[model samples]
Target: MFSPEGPGLRELAVQALSSVERGYDLLAPKFDHTPFRTPDAVLDAVAAALTRMGPFGNGLDLCCGTGAGTVVPARVCRDSVTGVDFSAGMLAVARRRALPAGPRVHWVRADARALPFAPVFDLVVSFGAFGHFLPRELPGLFAQVRSVLRPGGRFAFPLVAPPRPGSPAYWALLGFDAVMRVRNAVWRPPFVMYYRTFRPSDVRRELTRAGFRVELHALPEFGRRRDGSPRVRLVVARRPAR
Candidate 1:
C-alpha cells in the first residue's frame, strides 16, 4: 500500500504512536509517496467537475495535506488559491511541490476547526481528510467552512461508497477502525482517523444543519459498484445566497 520511497514499518509505528500533528510532521516528507496521499486521478476528476461549474473566485482547500486539492481550484478559480492545514511539515512540502500552471497558490498553517479568514471564498474543497474528524466535530467544522465562504459559495468533497458487507475491503476498513479505536483507548492524543464514522446520510444531515443546500454530483469516472450505485460521488454544499 506504500511506495518504495514511503515511510517504513518502523517509521509508521513511530508516527502511529505520536500525536496526530507530530505524526504528520514526521511523515510529511514521505506522505505523497504513501497511499495516504489523495490520488491524482481523484484530483483530476474534481478539477473536471469544478471546471464544469467554473468561473469561481478565491478558493480555499481545507485540510489540504501537501496541497493536492489546490489544483482543483487553480484551474477554475479566477483569483487565488489558499491551502490550510495545521501541520507545518505538510505545508512545507506543499509549498515546495510543483503544480500545474494556473492561479497563484498560497499555503496557510491553521486548523480547520478555527480557520483564520472571513467569508471570502467562492469555493472550498477537501479530499480524504474527513476521517480525521469525529462525528460530533462535524457541526463546528462545517460551520467553520461556512463562515469562510461567501454566500452561494460551494464546499465540496468526494465520498466513495462504503465497501459491501463481508467483502474483503469491508473487513479491512472494519479492522482498521477497530484498531484505531483500541489505539485511542490506550494512547495519548489519539490519531483520530475512523473511516466508518463518516457516513453519507450523516454528512448530508450535518451539512444541511450547517445551512448548506446540499447536492450530489456523480463522478462517473470511477464507474459503479455491482449494486449499480455510484462508486464515487461529489458532495457539493452551497451556502445560502442571501
Candidate 2:
C-alpha cells in the first residue's frame, strides 16, 4: 500500500512502537510518499466542491498535517488561511514547502480539541485526521471546530464509504484494528487509528448534535459501489447563522 519512497518495514516497526506524536515526527519526512498522505485527487475534488459552495473569506485547516488541507482553503478562501496542528515537525515541513503567499498562511501549533482561534473563519477543512480522535471525543472536537467558524461557516471533510463485509479491504482494516488494539494494550502513548470506528451514520448524528447542518455530496471521481452508493463523499456541515 506504500510507494517505493514510503517507509520501510523497519521504519514502520519503529514508528508503531513509538508514541503517536513522536512516531509522526519520525515519519513526517517520508509521509507524503505513503498512502497515509491525503491523495491529490481528493484534495482537488474537495477544493472544487468548496469553490462551488464558497467565496469563503478566511479559512482554517483543522489538524492540518504538512499543510495539504491548508492548500484547499488557500485556493478557495480570498483573504487568509491558518493551518493548525500540534506537531512541530509536521509544521516545519509545511513551512519549508512553497505555498501561495498572497493569502497569508499562518501555521499554529495547537491541539484540535482546543483550537486557538475566535469565531473568525468562513471555511474549515480537515483531511485524514479523524481516526486520531476516538468516538467519545467527537462532541468536543466538533464543538471546537464550530467554535472557530464564523456564523454560517462550514466544516468540511471527505469520507470514503466502507468496504463490503467479505472484501479484502474490509479484512485488511479489521486486521489492522485488531493489531492496533493489541499494540495499545501493551504499549505507551497509543497510535490511535481504527478503520471501522467512524461510520457515516454515527458521524452525521454527532455532527448534527454539535450544531452543524450536515449534508453529503458525492464525489464522482471515486465512482460508486455495487449497492449504487457513492464510493466517496464530501461531508459538508454548516454552522447555523444564529
Candidate 2 lDDT, 1-242, residue by residue in tens? 79898899999999999877888888888888889899999999999999999989999988888886678999899999999988887888888767766688899999999988999999999999998889999999999999999999999999999889999999999999999999999988789888888999999999999999999999998899888999999999999999
- Model 1 regions lying over 4 Å from their true place: none
**Model 1, residue 124: what's the lDDT?**
95
In the range 1-242, model 1's lDDT, one tens digit per residue, is: 89899999999999999988999999999998998888888889988988898789999989998886778888889889999999999999999978777788889999999999999999999999999999999999999999999999999999999999999999999999999999999989889989999999999999999999999998989999887899999999999999
Clashing pairs in 1: none
Model 2 steric clash pairs: none
Candidates in order have lDDT scores of: 0.92, 0.91
**RMSD, one per candidate, in order:** 0.8, 1.0
